[model samples]
Target: PWSSRYGRRNRYGPSPTVKVATPRDIRAFFMESESMPRSDYLSFPNRDTIDDTIADMQALAEQVLLKVDKTIEDQIPPPTAVLEDELPLHYDGLELTNGVTTVFMFSFPDMDIILPQVDIYGWTPDVMSSGVFDISSGNAVAWEDENLRVGLWLHSGWNQTAKMLQQYLELNDARYRREVWTMDEFLETNVIGSKVFIQQYDSFRNAKIVAAVRVPPEGVYAVASHVMDLATYLEETYPGHGFEKIIDRSDVLMIYFCGRQLTGEKAHPDLPTAQQSRFIIALVPEGS
Candidate 1:
């Protein structure tokens, strides 16, 4: 089981309920909390690069939003510069490709464990895969080999994490048409072939979008290993409740996301550590 300070709860007594704030809420907090150090690392594009894409899809009555990965700080050095098509890597080596997927967002302040929340809209397949549909012509097309994507939310006490986890499971079940597991299932099946766990530049900023449209079997195995590790950690840290009934229902397969492993500590001095954090739950396609 993975051990960390995050696992050990209040040693003195039962902790208070932590109010998990939304990204919009966090953005608001950042605006108000002058004392809180500004996250200089949070970068926004100057122009709306996807305006045309948005306009083209507007006829479909869809709202356009930006997908951001909080782990960018761990990937690139100071003055992070990534091309629009670039995909950043997650700590688990899943490449942050361009597609719709669910994400978990959380905040931790002064031991206030702001548990993760499901953000289905933050990055959904239909929304993330821009240019795939032509609203004007009312036609849908498959995405090219090269594409990239990004995106998450919050909840309470120890039950907070559980609740959020449940929400994520439910949302994923409804949205995605595939088998998803929480990690335990991978171990049970022994399908996790390759494991890559090292503290390095495993952030979104460092990842490049997958040049290929379809991920091969090797790619699937690499991601499954990380998913398995996360599941084991979650199971050990928060045992019982059958891990929101997701892990118990797993087939041990995995879906790959933004991660391309890099080596060594490429820490940025200006960026404040722990600005925001996220946990990912993915859908594993079988026959990997």
Candidate 2:
């Protein structure tokens, strides 16, 4: 969409810097599970299609396993047992209540600790970053673009991480309840009012907060520059973890893992200044 309005004058300069994830890359994820010691076959579902299972033993003799993240490996939950006899016919052999999938998590400074699989009550938005994974297909469950395939999902997922940011709002409103907003109208209302709207999304603080907005090609820079500034602020506020804007699509969806209710504390001290008002207001649930 940005390309259409601006005639695609290399909006962000060269091609998108964010590398899209591919199906092959997703398939390789299985290798990590394969190397893990399994107590039973069900622990690692879909075993028959593993590369090692179909590869010649001689050819694999000299190969070594890729290193897995020790933190994730150590924290992987054990399989839960299900009593099939006690279940109804439709539910037979289906571990509906107990299924496991790997998700990415991030730790940030001045942020509460997040435990993805362990926090069953959803009291805290413990998982800072993660994507829905399709266990049966061994692929990421996300939006797909013709050119990027699964990469669109990965890029969009990353782009959406702004939802987790701790925002400092000088003003608030009740009207930002929609899932999508036009960039021009959003800026006209919230930015001009110096307001950030996100109060009605979910009563629970830990619920996932997602918002999207569409910007015309001509006005793309108006929003993008502020977003990049926020990205920079995020990097400065939280060390080690930083935001990357690799996608320049007109419709942008942002996701935030709500930690406690929205707080008055500024994510960074410099936010909401006269020039940064748009940046601060844009971080609300109304998108863009």
- Per TM-score, the best of the predicted structures is 1
Error of 1 at 199 (Å): 30
Error of 2 at 5 (Å): 30
lDDT of 1 by residue, 1-288 (tens): 111100112123355222222223323322232123433221211121212345445522321121123355422222112223323332234333222232322221211212322211121122212322211111111111111111112221112223333322212233321232332342222212222111223332111111111122223322223322434433454454133333443322122221111112232333232121122332222222
Model 2 C-alpha lDDT per residue in residues 1-288, reported as the tens digit of each score? 212211111123445222233433333332232232322111111222123343444323322112122355333532222222222111112111223222322222223322222111010011112212211112222211222211111111111222222121111243222222233344343333232221112321111112222222232223323322333443343222212231333222222121111122222232211111122211211223
Which residue pairs in candidate 2 have backbone atoms (N, alpha carbon, C) closer than 3 angstroms, thus clashing? 114-126, 160-255, 163-255, 163-256, 164-256
lDDT at position 90, candidate 2: 12
Report the Cα lDDT for residue 162, model 2.
24
Candidate that would win on lDDT:
1
Worst ten in a row by lDDT for model 2: 119-128
Show where candidate 1 strays beyond 4 Å: 1-40, 43-228, 240-274, 285-288
CA-lDDT, candidates in order:
0.25, 0.23
